[model samples]
Target: MVVEYEDSLEESSYSAAAHEPQDTARLAINASRQDDLADIIFLANNRRVTDMVASMPHPFTLEDAKALVKRSEAGHMGNTLFAIRMKNTGRFIGAIGYAPSMEDGGACHLGYWIGEPFWGQGYATEAAHAMVDFAFSDGGISTLTASCHVNNPASRRVLEKCGFQFREQSKMRMSGNSGLVNVDRFSLTRSTWKALKAWGQAA
Candidate 1:
């Protein structure tokens, strides 16, 4: 399924400067660039990374990375993809985006991945937060869903941190495993996001 953005939304709307205090910001999300091909190939080719994602193919190659950048340029499955870049150096460290889901009511699915070298540093959670905000505020989305392999506790933590609540357990085809795997699904609604934002401001 492909989630379609409103025609009123421009490509520039996908660019987000996440985390406050520009100089102190750790990262920013922006449209993917051709220059990011080498970095995407280098980071995405790792088994440790692709193994965690469902659609990413193992033995990831330069052509695959080039296709990814092209998709980002042209819109991947009707969804805009973003590069997760370090604020200080402007280096691409990962990718993140939302896609259409089979779920009723126009719910979209959120997905992201970071380089193996950048893991354990809270990049996933930061990116998730930024993406969630962007989806609700700028993307005109009402519902967002996500899932992670049951064994990936780190990913589950990232979803929970972004205010996604557990929904159900399901099976999905993982390209790395070449079979269906158990996954834990989660979802968040616009109302819940608004409440969370209010609570955070009050706190």
Candidate 2:
């Protein structure tokens, strides 16, 4: 179901930020909003977060955050971007989503991140699970693929926990940071996801 917020942010659609709703769950995924500008900037501006994701720009700014919302809202046929929020506090911690293939392949790449401070707390795993469930159930995608820098063990664990099997190894171009880095690839097909869910529900 699509959720909506009143967007207390009064400035131009891209001018400022808003207050996240308060709840008690560990994490929740929802559409990015104009009011989330400050949190996105505060959490994503760190080098620790920026260095891991390929497309993210370093020294991330409010304008960068604004641009992201615009791009995500533009709506690719099979792509979606979501905000990872702390349920109890309504704070934006990071982002996650699938980017559709330009070739119209029945697959898309999964990507996600959580703030440095929020790491090691299982938030990434929870967010990834929600995204995977959505991709296969509502999104109607056949396959989900993801990659992690060989150096990033934390990310590798998250993808593995989400049921992505090791596919291969490849090199990825880092956005702001120049050199290419070796990345471990992983994928989860719809049939596998259904089997796993069946076992999960049975258990």
Highest TM-score scorer = 1
Candidate 1 at 203: error in angstroms? 0.6
* Structural RMSD, model 1: 6.4
lDDT of 1: 0.77
Each model's lDDT:
0.77, 0.74
Error of 1 at 92 (Å): 0.8
Q: Write the per-residue lDDT of candidate 2 for residues 135-183, one digit (tens) a residue.
A: 6653346798888889899999999888899988988887747668898
Can you list the residue pairs that collide in candidate 1?
A: 3-100
Candidate 2, superposed: residue stretches over 4 Å from native? 1-25, 101-106
Ten contiguous residues minimizing lDDT sum, candidate 2: 13-22
Q: What are the RMSD figures for all models against the true structure?
A: 6.4, 8.8
**Model 1 regions more than 4 Å off:** 1-24, 76-78, 103-106
